[model samples]
Target chain A: QQQVKQSPQSLIVQKGGISIINCAYENTAFDYFPWYQQFPGKGPALLIAIRPDVSEKKEGRFTISFNKSAKQFSLHIMDSQPGDSATYFCAASHRSNDYKLSFGAGTTVTVRA
Target chain B: GAGVSQSPSNKVTEKGKDVELRCDPISGHTALYWYRQSLGQGLEFLIYFQGNSAPDKSGLPSDRFSAERTGGSVSTLTIQRTQQEDSAVYLCASTLWGGEAFFGQGTRLTVV
Candidate 1:
């Protein structure tokens, strides 16, 4: 029962291009959404997060666009670089619901130079 | 010491045997989570512990899976009568409310 759904099992992008990954959920109670990045042999780390109150949030080359009505969200990587190659996972959680995060199947991004 | 730590980076056990995995969270982190990372399953939430309150075990796959945290610190995940399907990389993460979570390297478990 994966609450969050993610797309593009894997993608290959040219250097300096933009890589976009989309995610959707059915739980309206979810108020928080976060993206995690992981490299081989390492654990996933929090890359960015956004709350439903805000439509979007940007941190450096990463931006999160959230759509409350559609119960959808997306992560956009600007100027995709080789270093950005990793597995990206989208997760949803609500503060009132014990903060148990529901994760989507990951998307592996490969930025080729 | 500085980050979340998990033991026995790798483990292999016979089917029907029991195995225990350990996690030592960062100092003072109240939220601890256990997730299973399989080849295609991404990360599957297994259990959660928040401070001294009762652990949330809704995500546990079956009755053979159980966990407990001692003194609000170290935690352990135990699998009894292990089956081949139970083999997966077990990851542990720790975080505070509204903060970023820190994850360990994960223990790769193989039930033969």
Candidate 2:
């Protein structure tokens, strides 16, 4: 069973526009949601994360909007740029443990300049 | 400080052979994790080690896949009797307090 599901296998957005990626989880035990950005031939890097207590968390131009009741979370990138073109992965884990992340199938995003 | 480092960045082996992939986590980090990524697939958890305690091996795909951490610093993942289906990019990550994980460049394994 896929504990987390992500939408839009691929997305194309114009530069300076908003880019959104959504993820849903079936495990209520999950409390930490994190998004990772991966470029070709490199490892995934942590982008932004949110906890269940917060409905929204923003850092610079990146934001994570979470809905506990809906068991869903989304990543919003403001002023998307061509440099933002990469694969994004959404993952979730519990806080009590060592935070073993369960990942979703990645979404490839292309920000056209 | 340097981030996580994985050795043998790329390995190509014939079927039925054995291969060992190594990871050096960040200094002073107590948590280490291993994950595998296949083409067009999500990251699949393989194992985790915390300090000197017992590791979480539930995610290991089979007995052919095993890992060991020595001195709570470095780890090695061994794959025995490798098969074509075993080809994938193996990733290693480390965290200070299990919050945000820093990943290595990953080792690409190709089995023919």
Candidate 3:
């Protein structure tokens, strides 16, 4: 029930296109959802995050479309660039609990030039 | 360092030897967490500590793995009798409240 399943183990997209990664969870107690971007030989960095109170949150070129009822959320990258090429991970955690994040099997994205 | 810092960025030890990994979270952050990441895999929660509260060690893999946080600051993860299966990257993260977390570069342990 703690699992967050992510789709498209790997993705290849052209520049100027949209890159979308989807994730689903089973635990309904999760209130905070965050996406992380990680490069080789580096730890995951917090990219963008959202709460169940809002359905969608956008920051610059990154957008987090959340579906509380469906128990799913997605990260959408507009105008995907080569610099954005990296592994993305979706994570969820309950605010009231210990704050331990449950992450999904990462999705490796490759933006073609 | 301004961010979470881990020691011995790379450690290659012999099997059956004991190894200790360190984590120095961002100053003033009360919440700290430890995770393990294998190649091409997701982060595996190992433990969590919040201030002086009792740590949540439910995610620890075995008896050989243990950790301790001193004075609500630096933390050390001790792996006793390490095996080759323990070869992986150990990551540490910290957060101020209940929001996003900041991660360190991580310690890559290669048990040969």
Index of the highest-lDDT prediction = 2
- Fnat score for model 1: 0.63
Task: Give lDDT tens digits, candidate 3, residues B40-69.
Answer: 888999999999999999989999999999
Q: What is the CAPRI rating of model 2's predicted complex?
A: high
lDDT of 2 by residue, B1-112 (tens): 4999999999999999999999999999999999999999999999999998999999999999999999999999999999999999999999976568999999999999
lDDT of 1 by residue, A5-112 (tens): 998888999999999999999999998899999898788899999999999999999999998999999999999999999999999988887677788999999999
Q: Which pairs clash in model 1? A: none
Off by over 4 Å in 3: none
Better of 1 and 2 by DockQ: 2
| Candidates, DockQ | 0.74, 0.88, 0.84
* Chain B TM (all candidates): 0.98, 0.98, 0.98
Put down candidate 2 lDDT per residue, A1-113, tens digits, no spaces.
78999988999999999999999999999989999999999999999999899999999989999999999999999999999999999999996657999999999999998
Question: What does DockQ come to for candidate 1?
Answer: 0.74
lDDT of each: 0.93, 0.95, 0.94
